[model samples]
Target: MKQIVVIGGGPAGVEAAVAAAKGHSQVTLISEGPIGGRTGWDSLLPSKVWLHAAELAGVAEHTAEGVAIGAVHVTPTEVLNRIKQVAQRWSEREAQRLQAAGVKVVHGVAAFHSPHELIVRNDDSQQTLTADAVIIATGSVPRFPPTMKPDGQRIIAPRFASHLNTLPPDMIVIGGGPTGSEFASLFSRLGVKVTWIVGAPGVLPMFDPAAGAALAAAMTAHGATIHQVDVERAERTEGGVVVTTADGATHTAAMAFLAIGRVPDLSRLNLAAAGLEVGANGQLAVDNYGRTVAGHIFVVGDAAGGPMLANRALAQAWIAGRTAAELSAPGYCPHTVVSAVYTVPEIAQVGIVSGGEGELQRVRASYTASLKAYLSDETEGWVELIYDAVNRQIRGGIAVGTHAADMLAPVALAIQTGATIADLAAVFAAYPTLSEVVFAAARAVK
Candidate 1:
């Protein structure tokens, strides 16, 4: 059996080890902390739990037929405890699954002893393991420059955002990306004053402009004060944190959050010992198959660098595992990955966009046209579908509204299968549903 070692134990690492085991290879997974890594513990799942609570509160506030519900005031410590419980449950479940699949799961700090060898050390033990091939899925950590540091109290990193014992009366979030925006939204829902500092032209700048604008408007409606200021550095004060902007302006708040971005965490890997080089920013250069310069060492997930998302990591991990184990597997293409931002009215997009170096046409439909949306009092949404006018094949689409992620899947499938606008329009969807928005957009494509 081909022996494989996977490092990091995040979604990517766990998935890679599982894939290798499925390919009939002997696999070992090494994780520095709990098996879930950041996604399972800090980022994805916890945020979803908070978002779910926010959504329930929203639904209660907008209850129709004059039904009145008490105000929802969530206790921060209890919420944080809930997040920890959920994360532990998921980590244990994943660990159990990996063990059942015949993959050895080790908790330790791992570094490359050689290209084919790993030295793992825990508090009380150390071991040396050899593998035919190694997969590095070590994920990433929040990037904080020396000029701006998190104090774990007033000024905080995204990882510690959920652990706050009490919500500050006001917050200054320094980043316009998904993390910052999600926190801003959460604070706004919980009746905290938020000053959102956006470095980009607008929120979710990488997505379709319309979606970003809609989200900004929604945030503003929820009492968030939006500012187009780029934070250069931050300093903690006696009472709070002071953030200095690029234009020499300063903003103060009871608490500050740096959701700027993330860099791969490879401090302990000792890449040089494995005949590999890391970039100045700590990112590893990898090929389309997540292979490093060293043929035997492969990198996946956030370490490989693209959109830093859990689903993308899982996909890359599967491909890397299969390739490393010398098993037949379908190659992964970066363009096919789906991006979703889970705000109140979520935004999801995939594939090539309109007016982008081809004969592409764009069509739009509003959630107001969906009977289900109207019934649910969530009619503030829209869909923009782009298709190749030459062959009528769907190229890409954006969904911004209630269940936008779910609504965008069939369009993503159409793009994947080279299905035409006509093919999607002809399909029969259940009436009074948000999915009908897709059919409307397809039919409107002239």
Candidate 2:
């Protein structure tokens, strides 16, 4: 049987190890931190827990007349504890699953001594492992600027922000991507003053400009001050932190959350020994099959470095693990990756693809058109569908408002299956539902 070694116990490494074990390979997973990486612990899971809390807070603000809903206060320590408990449970569950799948899980720091050999060191112990194949899924870390460092107190990154025991009186969020936007929204919901300094003119640069504009407007209405400027430097202050922007303006807040970006964590792994050099941006270059320059080695997850999405990591891991184990891998395809921003009245998009001019068509349906949204007093968002004008086939769709993420799945499936606007419109959507917006969008397509 082939022997496979997978590094990093995050989403990618765990999936790869499990998939390889199912094949004709003896799999061992090496992880320095707890398994499940950032997705299960520091980043995705924790953020969602906070987002859900924010959502619940938003719901409580709209108490019905004469309804005696007791005071709901934001408890930062309790939330942090809940985040830790959930992440621990997930990590433990993943470990159990890996063991059941016949994959050996090792807790240690790993570095390559040769192409096929790895030296793993844990406190007070060490081991040498050799394998016919290796998979690197070391994941990524928040990129801290040289001029400004996170003190883990006033100045912090996403992971640190999640673990904050006390809510700040006021906070400045740098970087207007998903992480920054989510933090801004969360703080706003917690009744904390938020100043969002977005690098881009609008937030969520990856999505349609309209979606960003809508979200920005909503955040502003909900009490967030936004600056379309990039943070250049930061300095420790007597009270908190002072941040300077590229536009030569200085902002001060009780705390600063740096959602700037992330870099692949390969500092421990001396890649030169494995004949791998990270790209200029500190990302590992890998093919669709996740193979690096050294054919015997593969890369996935944040180590492969595109969007830093957990689903992408899981998908790539399946391909890399099976191929490394000499099992047939299903051909990888560039599919529509659906993404969402879990703010109140969430924003979600599915299967977006670029097309030639005049060939691409867009149609929109407003939330106000849905009776359910009107009844629920959530009539402030819209759904948009993008389709090929010539072929009339749906390419992608975006939904914003209550249940936006939940409403996006069917559209994503339709896009994947090459369903047309007419096909979407033909679906039997119940009256007054949020999903009716999708059917409305499809029917509006001309």
Candidate 3:
């Protein structure tokens, strides 16, 4: 049997280990904390839970149809407890499933003793294990600039912020990425004053410019103070934490959150000892198949340094795990993966956006045209489709609106299948639905 060692127990690690074990390989999954990864416990899932609550709170105030709510207030401690409970349940379930699949689960920090050897250390002791193949899915952690290092008291990172016992009266959120915006939105809805500082010209810069603007406008409507072109430098003061902009303007808040971005967590892995090249950011240099420079070693997830979504990590993990297992077995083809981001109004994309000159066919439709949006009073999003004009094949699609992540799945599948704009246009989506916007956009492509 081929012995495979999967490091890091996040989404990527769990998926990789599970998939590898299914291939009849002897797999060992190791994690420093309870399994299910950061997405399972900290970032993705917890954020969604909070967002769901926030959305409901919005609905309660706006009143969808005759549905009315009486005095809704969310306590920060209650939210934190729910997050912990869900995380614990998921971790336990994943542990049980792995054990049932005959995959060994190790609770420890794993370091490279050599290319094929791992030294696993926990609270008590250490053990050395050898594997024929090693997969690194160590994932990434939030990057806080040295000047703004979070003390975890008044100043914190997303991981710490998510589990706070009480909401601050005023919060300064640095970095206007998805996480930052989400934090700002959540807190603002919970009645906290939020100052959202975007180092870039606008928030959600990766999304379509229109989408970014709309999202920012929505957050602003909810009472968030948006500061563009602002770089925050954090400091502790007598009253509270003070964040100063590059222009020397200071803003004081009860708490500050650092959503600066993430860095690969591979520094301690000692990849050099394994003859693997790591990028300057500590990301492992991997091929399309997630193989490292060392033939037997592979890397996936955040450590691979592409899109850092949990779904993306899971997809890469599936590919790496199956490919590594196939090298030991025989036939397996990795599927094209889709990526999704769950911010308010969500953002999802698949395949590469065609930018270079070519016969390009594009279409866009507003969510306002959808009956569901009209009914739900959410008409501020849109769906965009892009196709090759020459071949008429779907190149990519992006959606920013309610259930956007779920709605984009079909487009992702179509792209993977080489479906054309006409092919998608012909498909019947349910009437008065958000998905119909996709169909409308596809049909508009010429």
lDDT of each: 0.85, 0.85, 0.79
Candidate 3 global TM-score: 0.94
Instruction: Write the residue-wise lDDT of candidate 3 on 56-99 in tens digits.
Output: 77678887767767998777688778888888888888888788
Write candidate 2's Cα lDDT for 172-232 as tens digits: 9887888888888888889999999988456888877777888899889988999997789
Residue pairs in steric clash, candidate 3?
Answer: 10-37
Q: lDDT, candidate 1, residue 140?
A: 85
- The TM-scores of all predictions, comma-separated, are 0.96, 0.94, 0.94
lDDT, candidate 1, 56-147, per-residue tens: 77788888876778876777787788888888899999998899889998889999898888999999899999989999998888788888
Off by over 4 Å in 1: 354-358
lDDT over C-alpha atoms for residue 266 of model 2:
84
Name the better of 1 and 2 by TM-score.
1
Model 1 scores a C-alpha lDDT of: 0.85
RMSD of each: 1.6, 2.0, 2.4
Give lDDT: candidate 3, residue 165. Answer: 82
Q: What is the lDDT of residue 398 in candidate 3?
A: 75
The TM-score between candidate 1 and the true structure equals 0.96
